[model samples]
Target: RFGMLETVSEFAGEQLAAHGELEMVRGQHARYFLALGEAAAPHLRVAGQTAWMDRLEAEHPNLRAALAWLLAAREGEEAVRLAGALWWFWYIRGYPSEGQQWLSRTLASGGSSIARAAALVGAGWFALDQGDVTPGLAALEEAVALQRAAGDRQGIATALNWLGNAYVHERQYARAEQIHTEVLALRRQLDDQPGIAASLANLAGC
Candidate 1:
């Protein structure tokens, strides 16, 4: 949890630029945090949730710095990876607005289909949370399509789950039920107990 004052950080940045090492150093920093985010992603969903959340929270500023550097460098794929990994943290920690902005930027920059799909899931959820239905639905639908194309069953299930939630939010009960039913079937095949329970709850709500 070490940090420098704003002025000190700015001064260090200037020095790095003067030394012509800024890009290299920033790239390294971004990659390091990218790995950290990816490692924490699963933990955030289940076991060690609180511990992982706290660790991520402590590194939030550094994570933002890494993402900013990646975006500034036009490293689209890395940016997408980092944003995709961290979106859940932003969502649960109540930073959906910021998360949406980062995801939007990464998406616009473009990346691999699978990575982009993951980012879309995050973007879609944030948009829905912010009450923007059209873009939200569009993003989620696109993500599901991409995941299907890639044969990423888990990814498809996750995207479908969110898509179902979006339909529920829009009060499209029948559509939501259909989507959740599909998700439930997928979860059962995967033997994901948590996902099965969630899908059942979603179906019940629908």
Candidate 2:
């Protein structure tokens, strides 16, 4: 959690740029935080969730800096990856609006299909949370199509689960039920017990 004084940090940054190393250094920094975010992502969903959340919270500033650099550099794919990894953190930390903005900007910048699909899932959920149904539904639908084309079964199931929730939000119970049923089947096929439980719960709600 160490950090330099603002003046010192600025001076060092200037020196790096003077030496033609700023871009390289920034890239490394962004990649490091991206790895950190991805590593913490799984932990945030399961055991020791609070601990991982705290860890991310402590690194939040650095994570933002990394994302900002990535976006400024036009590293669309890397930016998407970083934002996607941090989406859950933003959601749980009550920063859905900010998360949505970052996701939207990164998506607009373009990325690989898989990366973009993952970011779309996050963006869609944020949009839905904010009651923007049309764009949210569109994002999730596109995510599903992209994930399906990429043969990412897990991604498809995840996106579908969110889509089902969106349908429920819109009071389209029949469509929600259909989507949840498909999610249940997919979870069973993947032997994802947690996902299976979620799908069942969603179906029950529908």
Per lDDT, the best of the predicted structures is: 1
Model 2 residue runs over 4 Å out of place are none
Error of 1 at 115 (Å): 1.0
Give me the displacement of residue 101 in model 2, in angstroms. 1.2
**Mind giving the per-residue lDDT tens digits that candidate 1 earns over 101-200?**
9999989987899889889999998888888889999999999999999998899999899899999999999999999999999999999999999898
lDDT value, residue 14 of candidate 2: 99
What is the Cα-based lDDT of residue 171 in candidate 1? Answer: 97
Indicate the residue-level lDDT of 107 in model 2.
Answer: 88
lDDT per residue (tens digit) for residues 1-206 in model 2: 53689999999999999999999998898899999998988787787899999999999899998999999999999999889888999999988888888998888887899989879989988988888889999999999999899988898898898889889989999999999999999999999999998888899999
| Cα shift from native, residue 200, model 2 (Å) | 1.5
Give the residue spans of candidate 1 off by over 4 A: 5-15
